[model samples]
Target: MKRISNLLIAFVAIEHILFLIMEMFLWQTPFVIQRFNMTEQIAKDSALLAMNQGLYNGFLAAGLIWSLLIRSYVEQAFKIKLFFLSCVVIAGIFGALTVKISILVIQALPALIGLVVVYLSKPQENYDVVI
Candidate 1:
């Protein structure tokens, strides 16, 4: 379980980095346009917009990184994870709704792992005894 949790965190970190690249660089490129089924003109016209969108994704990645650091805040960490996971879920839904290349598997895979980690890892409380 510990190993799986570590792997899950690592996987999400890498996935977010990839998203940073996709949004920051490839979003307006021919590759992205074709993959997302957007017009080449639109891609060319909205390079900055894509990068801006990528910044929000980067923020979520930053939050995940923070969560990994402070294990004491177990509930808070899970809440952060859920927030980002919800974003991914909504994005997947939008992609599906619009018939775009949603990449639902990739979006959901890390979230599923994180959710499992949270579900399986029990919190340890330190009780104070007055002397």
Candidate 2:
């Protein structure tokens, strides 16, 4: 279960990283345009906004990676994971509400699952520190 959680978290991180790339660098491409269902001119007009959004996505990926590097069966680690996953979920929901419903499925759902998995991924009692 823990392994699955870790993988899910990593997957979310990777997805967001791709989002960063797409929004930051490829926003004007035909493929990217189709993904967002925007016309070429609209894509051009929104390029700056998309780049800003991409930067935020990059930050989210960085947070998730930071959480992974704090490898310990400690409450702090759990809190970090939960916090970042929550950020992803919230951002996803906001994007879905304001931008596109597909954001919920493409961005938020994995984080939501990661949140549940992280909650249950706590190590055994033996691994808990008493100090």
Candidate number achieving the greatest TM-score relative to the actual structure: 2
Highest lDDT: give the candidate number: 2
lDDT of 2 at 124: 59
How many pairs of residues in model 2 come into backbone collision?
0
**Model 1 Cα displacement at 23 (Å)?**
1.4
Colliding residue pairs in candidate 2: none
Model 2 segments beyond 4 Å from truth? 123-131
Give me candidate 1's TM-score against the actual structure.
Answer: 0.72
Candidate 1 structure quality by residue, lDDT tens digits, 18-129: 8889989888777888877789888878778878878877876787677677777766765665566556556655645655454566766566656667546634544322
Each prediction's Cα RMSD?
5.6, 3.6
Q: How do the predictions measure up, each by TM-score?
A: 0.72, 0.90
Position 42, candidate 1: lDDT: 82
Displacement of residue 77 (Cα, Å) in model 1 is: 3.5
lDDT of 2 by residue, 48-105 (tens): 9999999999999998888888886456766778888999999999989999999899
